[model samples]
Target: MNFKRFLKWLAPVSLTAILILCTIVQGWSAPTAAQTQLHWYGQSAFKLTTPTGKVILIDPWITNPVNPNGKTDLATLNRADLILVTHGHFDHVGDAMTIAKKTNAPLVSTADLGQALVESGYPKNLVTLDTQGNFGGEISLLNNEVKVAFIPAIHSSVIASDGSPAKYAGNPGGFLVTVQNGPTIYHTGDTDVFADMALIPRFRKVTLMLACIGDRFTMGPQRAATAVGYVKPDRVIPMHFGTFPALTGTPAAFAAELKQQRVGSRLQVMKVGETIRL
Candidate 1:
């Protein structure tokens, strides 16, 4: 009613509005969110850290032959919010049960593969319907900080325990991992190049594609290059290569193939024990 009363109310309201606008408008003024981090442990194993610091491990073969520091990495890794196994192959499932037993991170995979993992010594209770899904099915986890969609991969999957026969686990698949305020990453689990990979970009643009370039098991450089062309990610990282004498695919060859295919994705070749912010 009074002029003095109105002026006091407007002053506080204007200051509050200015502060809110500053946070909303200023990109360079202050750091709004932390950058996502990615760590490679040789082979297809990777540790993805969200901007909010939640950890997701995909195909965590930490102690693969190529990673000289695998033992140390495995020993020192104490935190994992989620353990995502793309398949039931020994190499891809490496150290997952050990990590799960220690960290109690839930198993994210198809129901069959999850059951196999549980039988193979993973914490039984951690394998739940919420984290397991089939191809084309998407599940939001980590309080919605991360969302994962199972995508098809042209590969086979099986599980075996010590002194036990191998059993067919489930259909092999890859993962489309979307991190909040970070990036969408496609981890191609031990796959050959398939035509349907082109369909991935129609649903959500992939920021990074973690591709397999090992020749004997997965696609070599040339085939992987085609997969890169299909996915058309902003950046592509070659994985599952040079981990053994059999895995002769090199990043150098991969780069040449990418250039030959005229693929526009940036090739980010990470070292076995290196960590980088994305």
Candidate 2:
């Protein structure tokens, strides 16, 4: 073969290799409209776009401190099929009302927290009984494309707005979101390490884990690493840290601890306002 033909053959092959490498390093799949996409808005906020264009927001704190474009993202979001709030705290419940009002998204949460959100002005119709569940219960959402299970968390929950005395909002919790033809994501909400986490993978293999590494309020690097070991997800992303002075834990520290603990989970450090395909 002549040098010209050889070069032509190498070009597409080289491009394919580069794309694969990028996917491995960046935790991104091949760019396609039919792929499941995940967007992080700092803190515990996440938007998941399913393959069929259904949108689900988890702990929709769009205006958190770490997110610079919080307001813009909030305003531009025109569609939200479902909104899942792990608890009724202000931070975790951030912007849920605004988004739900605009998109008519149903709120998936424990029954007590759902009632509290409705009382706090969340759309009553949207917070219907179908979406409300308890711990150890799973609800099929978005035409069965996504299934969300209410998981227990070691945290407190209260709904307090405008300093008007906190109201009891049942228990804090996390979610196990299983996406069809996509990844099974575990959002750890704001919880410390617990033994039941070990039983999570027994049900379904976790593709991604959104874990809290913020020390003061939630699990630090060490405890978070232990939690990761229990679930053993395919990839782990650290969150709920660095938005405030009190949340001192960092992804760097979390990575070191994962290594020290001999946890085999792959760590994917997501930046605020970043999106990745799964």
Per-residue lDDT over 1-278 for candidate 1, one digit per residue giving the tens place of the 0 to 100 score? 79999999899999999999888887556656699999999899999999988999999989999899999899999999999999999999999989998899999999989988887778889999989999999999999999999999998999877879998889999999999888999999999999999999999999999999999989999999999999999999999887778999999999999999899999999998899988
Count of backbone collisions in candidate 2: 0
Tens-digit per-residue lDDT, 1-278, candidate 2? 99999999999999999999988989856675588999999999999999988999999999999899999999999999999999988889999999999999999999999999889999899988889899999999877899998899999999999879899999999999999998999999999999999999999899999999999989999999999999999999999999999999999999999999999999999989999999
lDDT of 2 at 227: 99
Best by lDDT: 2
Q: Which stretches of candidate 2 lie over 4 Å from their true place?
A: 1-33
Alpha carbon RMSD to native, model 2: 8.4
Candidate 1 is scored at a TM of: 0.89
